[model samples]
Target chain A: MNESGHNGLVERVAHELKRSIKIDPSFDESVMAEVRRHGKPAMWVRVIAWWRRPQQLSLSPLSMAASAAVLILAVAVSPVRFGNPDGVEPIAEDPAARVIRFELDAPRASSVTLSGDFNDWDLEATPMTRTSSGEWVTTVKLVPGRYEYTFVVDGDKWVPDPAAPPSLFDDFGGTSSTITVPEV
Target chain B: MVESDGQLVRSVLAGDVDRYAILVERYRDRLGRYAYRMLGNLEDSEEVLQDTFVRAFKSLKNCQDPELFGRWVFKILVNRARTAGSIRGRRDRLFVTDEIAILNASDMKQSEYGWREEIERALSELPADQREAFILKYVEELRYDEMAEVTGVGVSALKMRVNRACRRLRELLEGVYRE
Candidate 1:
């Protein structure tokens, strides 16, 4: 075949190939139903839901009362030393190094691991222990810096911490929670 | 005035979930054609299309450029078609010629020529990458840059794939046309 003949054949093929199939009229409605079924809440809605969730207090009432009483007794026993009698000022202790407790409510998860920038995103670095109340808990001593992290449930399923600040979507198509550890 | 895809995307993101139907209606036929050619079956194509729309709706916010919503959704459709194709491959034999497709082709041509079957056979015989490149280039009439954006492959590589696909397709269908 000549050049134009081959070109004509190709064009014919393209034309035939480009023919639109008659889609089912109800396909759009079916797709919309599926979309509604799997609808993701807006970012602000997720934020509001997180905000409205009931918080679990870490300390028992008896322990809190005892701590308050001890603090009051210590303040009463200590002399009012507004400024040191000596000319020297007391050196402040380093507050950058501290432990932050991370917790998640995953009662059904057999194992939960925490991975983040702190541990180079290693899945096995920090495994969370399940409390009797079915909360997965872990406390990691992190330096004062912003860290991105996610919880791995059952060795897969990376999930962002619900209680943490807003998360950014990672390159791997998952969201990572961000935490800024402030100096005490 | 008709709203652009960007406006619809924004409305959907702003809690007007129903606005997404506009996008689905707009792109379904076009994307459905691409999926039908890619998968060679209407049922699989519809399944992939449904999946693509649902995914696009859920991830509408993650779309970096709402103005390029068509391209973004096309990319998702391509990926879903690939995945669905492979899964379908494992479960069933590849490429069962659809009776409806053949009937439609006969209706269009008003003749008994089975050119559509031959073309679909030729297309199904090509490697997935080459077939995708060819369909995007010729049938979809996408530029190399746009093809690159959709497939995440370099322009030169896509060009080579399209060339190879054309050569292979012509070879496959040469006897059919000669007859």
Candidate 2:
């Protein structure tokens, strides 16, 4: 057969097949029910639900306010300095800051470095120290916030923190680990 | 306004679990037809469809682009249908008599059009890969690129499969067309 005739035949077959097939109405309902049975709320929804949920407090508002007032009065009455009373020097210590220790096991690796949102993914910014037990470890002070990071092994392979939450695939086709440092 | 697939996907991911029904409803018919054609049976097709939707829901977050949700879900359905078809094929081989009885019953229901029966029989006789390629290209009217994405096969190979399928189908249905 000529190409056009062949094309016409194919189109006719497709149309006939298409016209003959009809999905049962209940198919969608059945599928939806099965999905509902197995489907959980998306991650974001669960997080929002957690946020909107009412939290119980041990102290009533009136009592809590009264306690706060009393504490303020006591603090005012006392001569204790919350910080440098001279006001000449800035406070060097942040009570909300926390020291987070990052550890990775890389016995076969010659070197390991930590890189993440904290260090702007600068691979060389935080080099890890190898312990005698062959574990690479590093400590860094971080303020409370969410961060995505990865480890650079031997200044080449970028590996996500296996212990952290699921890593996000970056735009550069690389994986990065995520962490949320809670505010104290 | 009807929300795009991408919008619906975002809504579903934002915690509106019910919005997923919109997606299910949207693609059900098209995917059902594809699965039916691929599996050559309604029961296996529906099973694959249900499984595909559930799997898609669980992996929605990992869908790189929600805009192409149809293609992504179709890919999953295609894979599930292939697996289901394989299992069914094995069972049919073991229970050849039962398989023939079931097919004959099905053919009776579809016997209204002898041409339809001939086409369906010819389609089922094609190799699975060629049948898939032919259905996706000619029946589903998918572009070559879309077929490649869904089948994970290169465009040239898909074209060759479709060509081979057409040749074989013409040969099978020659008597019907001649009459």
Which parts of model 2 have CA positions greater than 4 angstroms off? A1-4, A42-184, B93-112
For model 1, report DockQ: 0.18
What lDDT tens digits, residue by residue, belong to model 2 across residues A86-183? 64555355567799999999899999988764553445668999999999999988889887677778755667777887544342233457788997
TM-score of each: 0.60, 0.57
Compared with the true structure, what per-residue lDDT tens digits does model 1 show for residues B48-134?
999889877776755767778998889888767765766665567466685566666545664434777778788888877788899
Instruction: Count backbone clashes in candidate 2.
Output: 1
Candidate achieving the largest lDDT: 1
Residue B167, candidate 2: how far off, in angstroms? 0.4
Residue pairs with clashing backbones, model 2 = A116-A149
In candidate 2 the C-alpha lDDT for residue B133 amounts to 91
- How would you class the docking of model 2? incorrect
Model 2 chain B worst lDDT window (10 residues)? B93-102
